[model samples]
Target: MLNEEKSTEAVSFDTEMSVEKAKDAKKTLKRLIKLLFNQKQKIIIVLFFAVVSLVFTMTAPLIFSKAINVIYEGIKNVSLSGVFNIKFDVIKELSLLLIAIYLLSSLSNFIQQHVMAAVAQTLVLNIRKDISEKLSRIPLKYYDTHKKGEILSKISNDLEKVSDTLQSGMMQFITAVLTIIGSVILMFSINWILTLIAFLTIILGVAATSIIGKKSIKYFTNRQESLGRFNGQIEEYFTGQMIIKTFNMEEEATKTVETSNSKLYSDEKKAQFITFAINPLIRLMNQIGYVLVAALGAIFVIQGRLSIGLIQAFFQYVDQASEPLTEAAYILNSLQAAIASLERVFEILDEEEETPDAANYKTISNPKGNISFEDVKFGYGKELILTGIDLEVKAGQKVAIVGPTGAGKTTLINLLMRFYELNGGKIKIDGIDITKLKRGHLRSLFGMVLQDSWLFDGSIKDNISYSREASTTSEAHQAAKLASADYFIRTLPHGYDTVINDENSSISQGQKQLLCIARAILANPCILILDEATSSVDTRTELEIQNAMDNLMRGRTSFIIAHRLSTIKNADKILVMDKGNIVEQGSHDELLAKNGLYSDIYNSQFARSITAKAL
Candidate 1:
């Protein structure tokens, strides 16, 4: 009972979100139709064949009625004889015509189906291409705000749904509508009273279906959202499985996933419950309509006003008319899922992209490694993280920034890369404001190797030479050698050609970081930034990497963010940051001489090491 109440509350909340999604669905559907319209020529041909098929199908009943009438005339004209026989010449001819029409209809159906399928596949291809382009253009903030699974759901799941709907549902809808309209008109030609009765039943069935559909569609939309959240959880949890196990959080993670799964299950059940009932309810209405048409036809025949053959034909028309109505209703109900999917996909497409650069942006031919920050202020939102910050770096200098976590060490790197726009002040390179230069051009002048090593699924050589497409194999080897990565890479079975799959679990984290260093080294940028580049490796590997980094940083202005005081002992200048401001700035020995914040931090780490050794 408690579960039931929780489900109700969840459903109610989901209903509101679903309603908003549904409102957008219509607009999204229109846009989808517009996309299909791009291949209007193929669609037009498909429509023509569909209509021709419907005409043959609709005319078959009239021909069948004619055959019945022909049989009646033949019986009436029969002469009394001991071996009396009746000729069915006219009936035979009509039967032959009906068979031919059915054969032609099948052929037309096949052609239309083939064309429509081709059109659907092409549309999906184009949409995927557009989505791929959209991903590259969307701002970094968009990625920060949205979960990876949600974006992927839009691309893969949502787009696939839209494609399925277009392939099958769209054509069914058009044909069903045409069948209904044509059946109604033909039924009227035979008997208006019976036609009216049939139409009333159709309207009642549609009304009931509409009521059910309205209730069900909300749940369907809710299910989509739940599924998205569930997928995101899976993606997050799977990627963080190591951390979860390390912390013994397996049970907690399972409970969290179960909660998400339960919500999805509830919504799916409610939605399916309502939607699945529509068909049976409509069938009930159709049965009632059949009874009325049959009973009424008998009375008309007995009154000598309606012929038996005509009544038979009218009965067939009633069946025909009601079927399309039922079909259209069901197709429309099913389209809700597709529409919900479309809404999500369109939401991504409609996200604001990164702003384009100024028409006449600055370009650097040969950037000197001179960087300065003048009164720079920044924050995630309202509270400034770095207020009234200033800094200056000369070419080919090694500058190390040491600070406690959340002291704006990484934020400075983010600002320098223009990953986020600053709230106040300016950062300049070679006396020119970085903001005046195009983002691509500005970023091209600097190279970064952060703590998190990003290596895509590719060969070792490919990963090493990612920054420079034109870099030769020799250049990649040289870069790897400089980063102390060449020997291990060469030891692999495929050497540089060994494929690094998505997980890259084949390579150690230290190796991955070394490859990243090699990549940055290959870029040959005027300025270099290393954010805890050696934090993940062992002492021995760190020494090797530190040596490689020293070589890489030569002839370039370098900024290093480090917590290990030993690593930065040789730094030309060490900036001791506290609470987002540089509290002290000088050479390492000078900072140690001050006996202030830097000394305290250095002593604390030394004490921790000695304490660990004693333990």
Candidate 2:
């Protein structure tokens, strides 16, 4: 994907840019809510606990007020020169009730938190599953056009944001709304004046939160975008570390990272500053409301218009209500950020998947490997890479394609493998149009060994048997021995069980090529594809690999993309491609006799080899 970079920009721009509009906020929110509703059982449990918790919490203040009133009345009577007596039983009962209320409140709160935790984790788990499944269905062009870092960022970073919101922020939002409602009712029951004063804070908080939230949407969106760009640079730069170091471009690479990093910092700062500004401003308004309520409460108590106990209860209500009011701003910001994240995640989900495999599709097993390309025309983008190409191959025929870079050598193999659909014309295998065949069935007919030699982090045995898992261990061992990989495997730490990865230097380039050849050998497909399979190895190793490839290709139709003309000298047929069309076709010697492009490339390579041998 980094190889597709064409612009002189500091780093490649994400194709997803400009799609994260504030307008999608509504749709994202609705979709998220719909996802939550899907977990109705858990949500119901959470809601039940929340109600119970709120009930217990609201009861505590009333009980405390009663106890305070009892004590105050007793003190007043005693101060009036009466015998000092207190309702000790009532005080005891009230104390016990308050303790029970608080304990129950805590229990309910714990239950709700526990249930919501499950809801949040489960929701994220399912979304990840959807994301994973969606990735498999999308066309290869998406990967070729889009930056890998951005793809990874959406999967990891954006999901984390959504997860964080659902985990705590969601519950906080629900509880905040509930607590505000209950506290307001109780506040009004005590005194409308104090409730009104408290509401001044709410009004101010709402106005400030609404304004800040709208402004921060773009900031958060930009923050994620900037992070995505930075991630792209990191992914590309690190993956290309070998090239960078070989060319001594460390400074240039660092500059790329720094450029993207600086942009990320600038955007994140703005997003964070705006998101956090709401809390303090709202809290300050709350403090002012608190002062006004407290002063008025004191004056009312002195005038005997409101009891000390009731005013204290009113103050408690104010604190309870104001708490949510203060958090309203923060929660709004979290929701907005989460929505932004969801927007990006949904972009992946909403991508146009590869046209579905047709219903009642055909299957091919043990195909005769008769392949024909009829006026095949294709392109990655608007510009065609391959145009009006026609070819015919009989069963078990050996075909070699040769060309310089960008000459459509690899693209031909890609089209043959059905990695990309043809823009025009039809490709037929054994006289059946490939479009009618199931993709899995079509691909299973061929085995491929690329020059890069891909191997996942797994046992060597697994790597060899990757193409055909149904192959027996004995078969894998035989394949390894045939490809000349068995000797190397035995020399390793764990022999056949030795773990290897793409980056494992323990296996030399030639050895990795051998393992890949072994994999192709194990599959035993009706056709084979060799894409510069021996180009990276030394001449000695190249000879060994060529022998293994010869064995694999024997009696099987094969298409080989060769850079060294000498390697394909014995090829049954050679197809010379320039630009996108086949310019020449014949046996190696027959094509060289023409003294055209194929002859020129071969003579140049031959001259180079002769000179290197002389040196």
lDDT for 242 in candidate 1 is 98
On the 0 to 100 scale, the lDDT of residue 204 in model 2 is 79
Show model 1 residue runs off by greater than 4 Å.
Answer: 1-23, 82-87
Candidate 2 lDDT tens digits, 343-458: 89999999988777879888775589999999999877667777899999999899999987777888788788777778999899999898888878888898888878789999
Cα lDDT computed for each candidate against the true fold: 0.83, 0.86
| Cα error of candidate 2 at position 554, Å | 1.2
Against the true structure, whose lDDT is highest?
2
Give the TM-scores of the predictions, in the order they appear: 0.92, 0.95
Each prediction's number of clashing residue pairs: 0, 0
CA-RMSD of model 1: 5.6
Model 2: clashing residue pairs? none
Q: Over the stretch 1-615, how does candidate 1's per-residue lDDT look in tens digits?
A: 001011121122221123353355567778988998999999999999999989987898888888777776667667766332445676678889999999998998888888898898899899888889998777665676567876787788878877887788778888888888888899999999988888899889878977876666677688888888888889989999999999999999999999989998998888777767778888898999889988998999889778888888888878787888777777887788888777777788898876677688888888888999999987665667678889999989999999887677877788888876788999999988888899889989988888888889889999989999999999999999988999999899999999995477789998998898999999999998888889888999889988888887888899998998889998988998877789999998898899999999999999999999999
